[model samples]
Target: MTIVNQLKISAVSIKGAKALEQNLLEKISKEKYKPHDLFLSLEKISNIYNVNKTTAQRALHSLVGKNYLYQIHGKGTFVAPPAVTFQVLVIADYETGTNNDFGSIFGIPAFLRGVLKKIDLEKYNYSPVMLTKKKFIEILPDIELIYRSCRGVIFFRNIDIFVKTLPVLKDKNIPSFFYGSDALLESVSNADCLVYNEGGITDLAINHLLKLSHKKISYLYIDESPTQKKRFNLFLQENKKYKFCTENDILYFKTIKELIHNNIIPDIKRLLKNGITAIICGQEEAGVYFLNKCLMAGIKIPGELSVLTISNYPICALTPVPLSAVHIPIEEDAGRCLELLIDIIEHGSKSEKHISKTTIVRRLST
Candidate 1:
């Protein structure tokens, strides 16, 4: 049966139930919630649609078996919020004539939507603007003029652009936030941020790998940026306690080409031959790239070399082997950053910084 028909067949119930279900479906259709988050609380639904409790409960019950809402043993129901939108302003060298950078502003955008359900606007009002580093420098006067009109500005990619522009905002008392791993912020040391917990996240992933009986664990990364270096150090620091991973056990790579140039495949082969059975990645994109590289070299994942990634990027879910990753609480962190910025703009609170916690999601690829 068609999905729509199936829903229609099941939605036919009491008048109030039908009305409540219609209200919810309309919200879902308009909001485009993921399939995983359809169950809504009867109380909330009733309160939102102004229906009686019975009708709301019946309406939710009708959606129960239709894959719209699933009930847990004891926890109350929750309807997922609509998709989120985060607008990031990036200044970078896009035409460097190399492969495109793996990171994007989309991850934090998706995350913000999930956590900021209480906000009236779910999507960002402005379009994300990408400017070349030179263009950004040249257009600073005009850019600052344009920036004044924006409700909020999110910066990724170039730390220099942010570092320079931030002074302007600081002078003007304009609230702004940065989202990424590598941004030089000693000048704006007091600015708010939504960044990975390089030390804590790496420590957790390495500890997990150590417990899995993998002695010689290799570290994979994209750029030798400060954030990646911090993560590499954290990985080694955590493993150092176990005596299995000394300086030799930790390996840092600049890029895919560099890894290949230095004969990484041969080195990995040697590690495997010498009983290295796992690898931890500094970021999700690097993890996916490393996994592909290992596969090309005919190495099996988990069975031969367990793989773990630090950042939880979207590609992890779609990879051949879903990656086990320490996920930054990006959405919650972004939402909190937005809230803090808005509050400071309105109330003029004087806070220094906002930091979010991280957690590990053990998936199939671990």
Candidate 2:
């Protein structure tokens, strides 16, 4: 027999059990049980309906099969929300000429893997929506449709888009969780956030160098994102504690393109002459390039100069001198983002913001 026929045959054997199931569904639809509210157990079901345990079980299972209820393994069944579709939308930033052509340089693939690992496939469906800044406006109507269809949204590396779309999402009462730095969260009110502690990473990298008796440290950064600005500010604050490198030691390039096109060789030589013995790089790509230039200029790693990258990219491991880095916990942050989003969806409550800590991954360069 076909699956539908088998389900019908099973329902017939239970007798009057089908009526019991409909009554239960009616109560659920009438808001007798709120979303995430627990349902009766097998014993309670049988007692209340004056039916056998087998009949109660069949009735409950039938409701589950119809998506009227959901059960957690080892935990009891709960009243499913009205229109509980079990779909989550993940919106990611897209950048041209980058790994995955989107996301941060550290690796979008690893971040996505972390999210997937934490998600329960049997209970939820995951859908990803990637768009560049230019494309977002053009396809916004379609995005609205997509947003309305999903239960909640998880945003990654797309602060601009998130900010722009926040109003509409709020109007529709859709819960959203942002996976980004604390600075990014400051703009949006009432939304859940899973932040990467950019300031903490700066502290970890700078403190490690200070302990090594390296005072004259320079910092390099590319891009003007809020997260990058926060890192730069934290580096300055830490430098104040030690009276290390002066204002001149801090450098900024508007974009990675600017960093590549401009020759900063003379500037590096000047810093080296000024007793700058160590450098903290904020961007991974720019850091790798600076390391190559320093090596080519006959600068010794750690002996004459030391370098530390503020990134957790796998490429850091394969570099000529494995780069010492303040490793951002991308995987942990992604997992936390998923967990928080799900909590908001199930309980209909806004979760408090969370910040993941960073760790220093020591390697040859430091």
Q: Which candidate is the best by TM-score?
A: 2
Task: Judge candidate 1 at residue 289 and give its lDDT.
Answer: 72
Give residue 251's lDDT in candidate 1 (0 to 100): 60
Q: What is the per-residue lDDT of model 2 for residues 14-99, given as tens digits with 9 covering 90 to 100?
A: 77678888878888888878888999999998888788777788889999998889999989999887553355666664354365
Local error of candidate 1 at 313, Å?
Answer: 1.1
The stretch of ten residues in a row with the least summed lDDT in candidate 1 is 80-89
Question: What is residue 75's positional error in candidate 2, in angstroms?
Answer: 32
Clashes of 1: 2
Would you list the C-alpha lDDT of every candidate in the order shown? 0.63, 0.74
Q: Which regions of candidate 1 deviate over 4 angstroms? A: 1-99, 105-119, 122-139, 143-148, 182-187, 221-223, 230-241, 260-263
Pairs clashing within candidate 2:
none
User: What is the number of backbone collisions in each predicted candidate, taken in the order shown?
Assistant: 2, 0
**After superposition, which runs of candidate 2 have C-alpha atoms over 4 Å from their true positions?**
1-85, 95-106, 123-149, 223-241
